[model samples]
Target chain A: MAIPTGPMDLVYRVLDDQLVDVEGQRCGRADDIEFDGGLGERPLLHAILSGSGTWHRRLPRPLRSVGARVFGTGLVGADVIQVPWDEVDDIGSVIRLKARARDLGLGQGDRRRAETVARLPDS
Target chain B: MKKVLQLALGIIAAIGGFVDIGELVFNAQAGAFFRYRLLWAVVVGVIGIVVFAEMTGRVAAVSGRPVFDTVRMRMGLTVGLVTLIASLVINLITLAAEVGGVAVVLNLLFDLNQSTLILLAVMGLVVIVYFVPFDGIERIFGYMGCALLVYVVAAVHLRPEWHQVAQGVVPSWHPSALYAYFVVGVIGAALVPYEVYFYSSGAIEDSWGVKDLNLNRANAALGFSLGGILSIALIMVSAEVFAPAQIDPGFLGTTALGAQRAFGETGLLLALLGMLFAVGGAAVECAFSGAYTLAQFAGWEWGKYRRPREAPRFTLAWMIFFALAFVVVETGVDPVLLTEYAVIFSVVALPLTYLPVLLMASDRTFMGDHVNGVLGNVIGWAFFVVILVVSLAAIPLMIITQGGSG
Candidate 1:
């Protein structure tokens, strides 16, 4: 997958978009985006952070810590599910990644739950 | 001819699936109190839902995103969190109410114990959800839900003054708080947020794409408009039957009594069957909507199309909702009253749920050639303002009217 190179609005376009792995399987969402630069310099997109805990980055300063303390570790106990910027293949309706969900260490909870659900009759 | 048959089936199913527990009771209650005066509010609601559902369905078809995805993306973490929590709470209560309603209708038909029927209803629903295909669920519920058309038939049989019924189409003001409360209830019940969640997610469940846009439009327009007509028929029947006798059709059974008076046992059976499926359909939709919103917001795999094993967490999510609703309904609260509260409170979540859809639908960058045209934008924003005002007014109106008792 060739990467599309250009400046893009990370806040609006990237964050909160659904994350799909190479097999077109949904893993998670871009809960928070990491940037490489700081201060007055141009910030380059570094990584996409997902999981319930990582999403509070968009909240106000006071509420952020409270939310982090409450649900800092996501449901599957992952502090954060991070996918590096280079793994991204494209960004359209969903953020397409060039790797499998397991390889990216994402969607762990659903996979675990899937095992239990598969034990049921219809599932 | 085949395409037209498909379109006809979709529209008919939509019409059948439109009325739920909230509209049934609320419309009947409104008619009993205000006669045909509240018909215009139902029209307002129909137009509002038509605009929003069409937009959200188009968004799903063209962009492959459902309502919750739009909610989290547009509103961000804080507001999205708020909307999710609020919607989940309301959906749970509504689910409980619908489950309770199904049980109540069953008890009426079979003369069985309510608690046992509640358990049976839940078990049956679990079985249906587990085994039936998504479209099968829609058609079974939607087609059987057409039994609610008996209200329309009963309304005509009662021979209400056509002029008075016509006058109800024009909004009239009453200087009573209870009247204001019923108007809000009528409109709020019509635009329940779960409908859109179920709708957009249903679009994705059916694998709709850009070519399905015409079907989406037909479903939203004709389906909901006809559903609005059913609601109006409920009001007219209530006005003609219960109002003159000073009877409040408060219970789910009492609402059916209106039909029974028109056509005896057959009408009663049809009304009860309609309520069972309509309310039963709502219970299923609420469970799925709860799961869909949570999964989409949290970025988990979700949908019935993926099968229970494939979408495990999504399956677990809806099953949890079902379990929770069972516990709630088992508490012996009045199902009709519970639905009334659900309808009134759901209004508060409308603005948060709808604003993102309107924003996403109109964005040329995201929607590409499918962005909302001038007419869609105008109507969308117009209804947005109406929703905002009603959201602010809902709680106060509930308090002042004592939940529409007086």
Candidate 2:
């Protein structure tokens, strides 16, 4: 019933989502997570986070490139991609989001988002 | 705590976000034309911006989305597209004026020719904006923008009747129509829609959530109210300087020169600084506003706070937007004409821009438990109605008045 979070708890939605490791690296965010309510067993949080590709289907092709650019191809190791829970040394003021930011494949999917957005009305 | 620093950031951004080229030229213009009699409209605009900015900041903090995102989800594609086009036009026009304004400032300070400096200034802004950290740029401009307060000092030096200015706070049906027009200009300049766009998007860029609502209110009120104070000072100075001379200011340069009437060389430096930074500050806000609106419209990750590479699409949109302003400026368009068109177009887009924010801020889906409280709704709706009326009359008024010069 309790999620061990403070302000950070408010940062998310659809609580109990999975956060997977970055492709071939040790970092990623909670793309999807599941929680089991078994009384006798230890409460388990299975977060399923991959790369930006997880949200790619909803995005059109051009939009997908935006995701790829901001995240990564998920085929190679990079910063700005998803950061897994383990790689998070801690949640301080800065997201400390797996300090390997220097190596992340930034802007990998920018074109995709731009294209998809351009096609839509900017309401 | 660190939260306090963040709150300070919000306040600073609010200061930078409060007034723009419209206020710079129009407010001073209002003073030159009508003096304290039109000061009420400035106050009305100030209150309107504060109310709208408050709602927008609240919306951003609660929904974790900027104003455009909410507009898109609420208004849907067709109407949203219309808003974007309108907002973009105003942004470009305002951007042109500010770009020209920067040139004028440099002209005043360095004795450079305005023509020579115009393109150079626009390009310089595009370059700084391309690489400067969004937060850093905002802070620098926001705090330094405080320099414009010297207007208040000069206005006070003249020692006008406070009660007469206070009397203008309420609408007078018995007053001259020209007086009414002047009042409308003050309000029009103050309630410029781009200001609210820049404000709300700035809130999102700062990553505000419900926890920051109080700070949002504080910043909107404090920073904007202070801006109002400076605007009134402009009105007073113009009343004092130009009224006796029977001189009407046709250019922003003349408006800056009015600063000399009350303060001497010291006044000149202060006015120059104010014009330079005021114009510069507005440029930054409108530019980011352009990018944020486009990015939010399409659901792309966008914020000045984010690295350029991280929000590539967003950054590119802004860069392109800035580039377009270059195209407009390089054409040697008159900034005053540009300001006139921009203000009128902003008047046209008034309802579309504010309505969506009012709707979403009231809705539970996006706001969750943090929806608009009673005071916010009342103020928001009241402003909505007023803006609608002004928007309806703006074109006709412009036509009849021949864009206010007639």
Candidate 3:
């Protein structure tokens, strides 16, 4: 929640219209902004990143779309998705994540979507 | 500039995705019958859509989950499935109506066999959806959809009495049962439940979250309000031309002539393009909504953002529904009848789809501090009440007014 203000507050911006991830990679778009203060005071930008849930959640009711959505938990939680302020590899054509999304936490429960469509002919 | 561009997706999506066949047909019908007398319904529908859409967007942005994903948590999976089924039915009817609208417009332009033209229209839609990549889908449709601006231009061109229009904007006591039915019709059509399902699901597709709340709010207000305005404009033109003549703009062709009467030949071309685009977009949205609600409920991957092969089952479900709707249109059913029925059934499904989203928006575990504020709850409940009344009265009104023509 706390975004740093100065250069130390270096927000991992996707400059010049850079994208976050490509293909079906574990990396996702900036889903949320994490911040720090002491667990609570001068809340500042702790990190900027995406959630694994965003990847799978992008799909509709009965199926999960993992391409940009997501599939694992390692890329989730409070820490895995967080890369401090130092790990944002390079801000280039894509904001390449330092670690693979699979290493983040791809698991059975991770990529599945909740059922929103009922009569989908079980294919 | 990139920030502007990223934000432009929200705006363009709002603009192009906002207006649909529902707005085009219903507003024209209302305008022909009541002029500005039912103007209040459009305003109300706009407010209702804004309250709920903003909530759904904020939930997606803050909680990182779309509304339907939370529906199962609140209602057990079975109840949630019931909602999905009900919502799917509404979406099917909506898709059929839009497909029919597409066919009718083709018939207007080419005078082809309605059945053959319907299949042609469906094919056009399938090709558009099948090949287009995901990211470009919204921007492409939204921008190309701006051609609908012609209806608003035509309304202004007609120059109706501003004083009389202002009076219609004020809600009045109308003794005519038919007029009351017309107001309910606009309210029903203007706030079709699938629009929110499609809209919020879209927020998820774009990977929006707490940071993008502003853009989401702007999308709801700008996109839906623009849609509501277009609906009113269609009504205005109809009222200006047909009200005096006492001619009902029942068919797609008649509605086009409403524009044609005001803008001459240019109006006809603009009307054709506008109707085709609006109807086509609505068909895509309704089909996807059917897919989105089901996929989100079941924990399956489903999105246009992915290639069809990636989420094969989810894509298959949506594609099946889309294909079925295409077939339904091929039966030569009248689009006007199809839309009227869709709106009424949508009135029934309204309470079901909305209640889950409203409750989810306020859930502390899901939404955290970003949950609905006091004003949000107030507006949300107020709209729910309106939905309840319409749900209760939809059938009776349809019977009593004999589908609003009596």
Candidate 4:
């Protein structure tokens, strides 16, 4: 269960895999990956990006802006969920995290939607 | 005793749940037009579904990831988004047809206006989703839909030539384009993508894990095969009753009359009641399947297990789907026609929906020791080729046959 090394390893093992929390709940998928360090240096894995904003960037150029606009996010500055690599416990079929999904703020949209529903007058 | 009862009930529910509006109408039409000719197609479709459904269910149970989730992972965002869009369009058409079918049955049972009944059907579905628990939804619709067993009884009672029925199971050549159209339509209706969406998501909702793998296999194999039996019975009933009279059963009422021909007023009542629940269950399946694909792909909170307030986006998706279907049905379009169109178009999306599951199910990295065995691989790849052929031919045949009207 050694952590996968090298860029090729990341492509097959980390990028686009589903994120699972400690309790085995699905958080989201790794739509995009963030890296750090300059050229000639070892590029360290930084964060796993999720959400429609990040996903839209992965679409074709013609579709990227349209997807962002339709999904209610800006193409360049949309809300890309950045989960630090430190939180990742394992990476296989799914990126297993050491924390809960809600604790990691992954359920922010769900919580926000729930708050909106709460404001509506009950029938 | 209790375990036996459970197994029997599951089989019965599968039988009832299997024959939705698409199967009811298309299979009946197939038999009416081609007599016993298209039975081979139904057999092929049933086995194909069994293989794929078991694969999807196994993938869901073992990995705790549903079909759409795997679809996005394996196919990547660009292709996944295209699949999502295609699936959504097909689901909308199907949802409209199913709700419309429910209204058609209700109108037959009662003397109500079709438009009013369509609205009522939408309301009924919304209430069921909002108030009923998931298990309650399954048992209510699943068991009640069993009234369709009357068709099986009617098929047997009509006493068609047994040898002809057996021969239909063996593939026969028909050079007509209309025959090919019905073949594709039957397969498309049999293996609609939404069924996989609903089944895999339902596995997650039911909390199935590795321990439930056997249950998953039994459910897919027994449930779908029995459902196929109900489909074959429908064809036989139509062959016995409609073919001789030269009646083209283009309407929902005409399909039910096959049952009435064999059993009279009591048979008519049972057929209508069965159609009501069967189509209603399909409406729920289509609506939920749409919501599931969108929510899972977008990584939004989902599941009928949570309150509407808890899974607001998921709840909103299905609600919007039902509302849109309501508008479409209210346009006074014929539900039977809508079903035929939906079935044909869905075949085009079949490859996009299923290709991902086949890829992941065979990958040992994902499926681990539970990866598809030799038989699974052979059957899986063989059906993949078959589905690809059907997907390519579906639209052309539709145009050539004018939706099989010849």
Candidate 5:
């Protein structure tokens, strides 16, 4: 696939896309996107943000609290995990990363829950 | 032969999986009250679901995004959050209704304690979800649920006027508010959002790729159309057996009587067995739908394809939903009544649930050359408009009809 050059359509292409690790394991979503630049300069993509509470903040004012209440904050002691844009391997149906989930501190909740689920018979 | 069997099984599963507690009772009520007049609404609603399901299934196959994932992406955070919450609440109510419905069937078959039956129902559901593979679950429930085809045969045996049944294919408006409510209800019940959510996610669960696109279309078209035929058969049976006598098919048992009147004890047994599997399938579907919506929206690792340990949150979500539904059922609420309310609320959520699927299906960025063709767009938009109108008109109709009391 040709690398997307120039401005990328973050909203349509990247934001809300599924995050898959280098090993092709499912991890999380691109809950939010971060950018960095000075006022007069074009902002460069910084990182992708994820975790339970991160996306809720993007909800409108009235629904923000409701989102937070429903989705909760910092599930499994991780409020948010960020992957620098440089680490992004490719963007397609899913946002692929160059690093494994644990390396990027993603999927912490899933790993934690998996341990408990593993103890169950035939799980 | 293997391909043929797979397609046949897929269609059979869709046919049997289509009618839930809501469709079973609602179609019967419509038939008992208005006889064959409301059959057009079933056709309309079934067509709508076919279009919607096909679009969602296609999107999942081509793009690997399920309905809830599309819900968040297209609608954005604010509206998506609202949609998620609304769908989750409605799905919970639906789950409760299905669990309670299973208990209702069990109670009719054997004189068991309602609470104990409800518990047994959830336990049965838990065991199935834990032990059965996805295809096995579909086959067990889908094939068993086909026992409901008894109604089709019974409807024919009862032998209503062929001309009258034909007339039902053309939509006609009746002056009564009760008539309008039933119209809205039959359509709403047919277009329940869980079907699409389950379908799209199931596409992903089955690991459907572009190669499965034709199969997806076949499944949606053939499966749901046959399912619609079952709904029509239900109406025909109820119209023949209950309409003339002025018997209201308000309860699940009442709905089965249409079969009993035609074939005696054998018919009754088939009806109950079918209801058990169909409603049981729905309970499982509803539970998985809730899990899919939450996990997909939140971007959690989810799918029955994953082991319970592999997709822990997803596993827990469905299990929690079943436990919560059991709690709801324990409160002694009427499952049939709950079915009515769930249908009504589900229709209200229909537009939110469907619009994203339509948008994403048509978007070239997501779907590439596989984006909905012109015919798909026309039917998709037309049904979208119909569901929106029905959503707006649903509450008032329910109120005016006093939940179809009149």
Candidate 6:
């Protein structure tokens, strides 16, 4: 696929799309997009930010902090995952990353819970 | 021949898995009170579910995203958050009701205490979730739910006037609040949001791809139609037995008596067994749907295809939902009443639940050439209007009728 040269091309194609790791496992969605330039200069896609923290940022200003707290992202101090644009291998129905979610530290909760599950007694 | 057998089993499982605690008593009560007057609502609901389920399956098969995933992406964060909160609340209520229904069924069967049965029901569900593979879960509950076919046989044995039954299928409206309430409840229960959440997610869990599009169509069309038939049969049986007696079949036990009245002891046992599995299956569906919605929206690893350690958060979400539902059930509320509330509240979430699926299914970007056809669009939008009106009116009607008491 041709690389998207303009912001319009990437707007719907990348923004809000579900993120899939190298193994095709769901990591999350592009809850917010980071642009490289401050303003006026040709803005370039920097990274795809995901997780409840990013989701909370999208809320209205009054609700943002409260939403984060209620969703437990703020309470737990969960950081938003940022995947650099270069790591995105393909942009299709889902945003496919070239790296594993674990390698990117995108699935920290899953990794943490996996350890707890590992210690549970077998039925 | 093997392919044909597989198709038949799929259809049977759909039929068996279709009715849950809400449908079981609500359809029965519809028949007992209004005879076949509410049959048209079931038809409307079945068709609505067929259209939506087919589209969701196609989207999942082709686009590889489940319903809630599309829901969150298409609606954006603010609207998506509202939908997510609504869906989770509805899911919890429905899950609690189904768990409660299971306890009631077990209590009736074993003559055990209801509170004790509720605890056992939660434990049994937890154990099943821990051990059963996704496919095994479907087959076990799906097949056992087939015992509900006793209602169909019982309906046939009653041998009602065929012409009258046919006439009932034609759309008719009643000004009575009670009638309108039942109509909304039946349709709402049929198109309950969790079914699509579970169905579309199941498509992904089963690893459906473009090659499975035909299978998806067959499953949605045939599976939901079969379920619709069972629902109608439940109404018919109740109409034949309870309508004449002027008895409202409020409890699960009362509904089973329709079968017993027709075929004696054997039919009653089959009906109760069918209720157990069907409601039990619904509890599992609700639990999984709750987890799937949360995990999918939050972008966590999810699916029964993964081991507990692999999808620990997903597993934890469902386990927590089951425990919460058990607590709700232990409050000594009537499970039947809870089912009614769940169905009504579910109607409120219908538009939010379905609008995203409809939009995604119609989008060429997502579905490619498989985008909804003209017929699908007409039916889809038409049902959207009906669902919107019902959503607005559901709560008011519930209050006015006191949950159809009048």
Q: Which candidate is the best by TM-score?
A: 5
* Clash totals, every prediction: 0, 36, 52, 0, 0, 0
Tens digit of lDDT per residue, candidate 1, span A1-123? 234467667888888899999987888999887789879999887888888877556677888878878758444337687789999998888899999999999898889999999998977
Model 5 DockQ class = medium
C-alpha local distance difference test of each model: 0.86, 0.66, 0.68, 0.83, 0.86, 0.84
Please give the ranking of all candidate structures by lDDT, highest first, separated by commas.
5, 1, 6, 4, 3, 2
Give the per-residue lDDT digits (tens) of candidate 6, residues B328-369.
888887888887888899889889879989999899977889
Whole-model lDDT, model 4: 0.83
Worst 10 residues of 6 chain B by lDDT: B4-13
In angstroms, the error of model 1 at A49 is 0.8
Provide the fnat value for model 6, as a fraction from 0 to 1.
0.70
Greater-DockQ candidate between 4 and 5: 5
Could you give the candidate ranking by DockQ, starting with the highest? 1, 5, 6, 4, 2, 3
Q: Who is ahead in lDDT, 5 or 6?
A: 5
Tell me the spans in candidate 5 whose CA falls farther than 4 Å from its real position. A65-77, B8-17
Calculate DockQ per candidate and list them.
0.80, 0.07, 0.03, 0.49, 0.76, 0.65
- Decreasing TM-score order of the candidates: 5, 1, 6, 4, 2, 3
Task: Report the lDDT tens digits of candidate 3 across residue range A19-116.
Answer: 12223332333444566788547887566544444433333556554433334433446423544444455543234545544454321223342132
lDDT of 2 by residue, A23-113 (tens): 2121223333335568889965432333444444334566667756654554523322433344544332112334343344333446445
RMSD of each: 2.1, 9.0, 10.6, 2.5, 1.8, 2.2
> Which lDDT tens digits does candidate 6 get at residues A1-123?
435555555556766778889997778778788889866899887988877777677788889878878754622225777788899898777888999998887888888888888786651
Clash-forming residue pairs, model 1: none
TM-score of each: 0.96, 0.76, 0.75, 0.94, 0.96, 0.95
DockQ of candidate 1, scored on C-alphas against the true complex (2 decimals): 0.80
Model 3, A113: alpha-carbon shift in Å? Answer: 16
Can you write out model 4's per-residue Cα lDDT over B258-313, one digit (the tens) per residue?
99999999999999998898888888888999999998987776889877776778
The docking category that best describes candidate 4 is medium
Docking outcome class, model 6:
medium
lDDT of 4 by residue, A1-123 (tens): 446664455666776677778976666778888899999999897888876777667788988778877764623333656788899998765788999887776756766777766663341
Residues B123-214 of candidate 5 have per-residue lDDT tens digits of 99999888888877877887788899899899899988989999998999889999989889988887888877888888888888999988
- Model 1 CA lDDT for position B11: 41
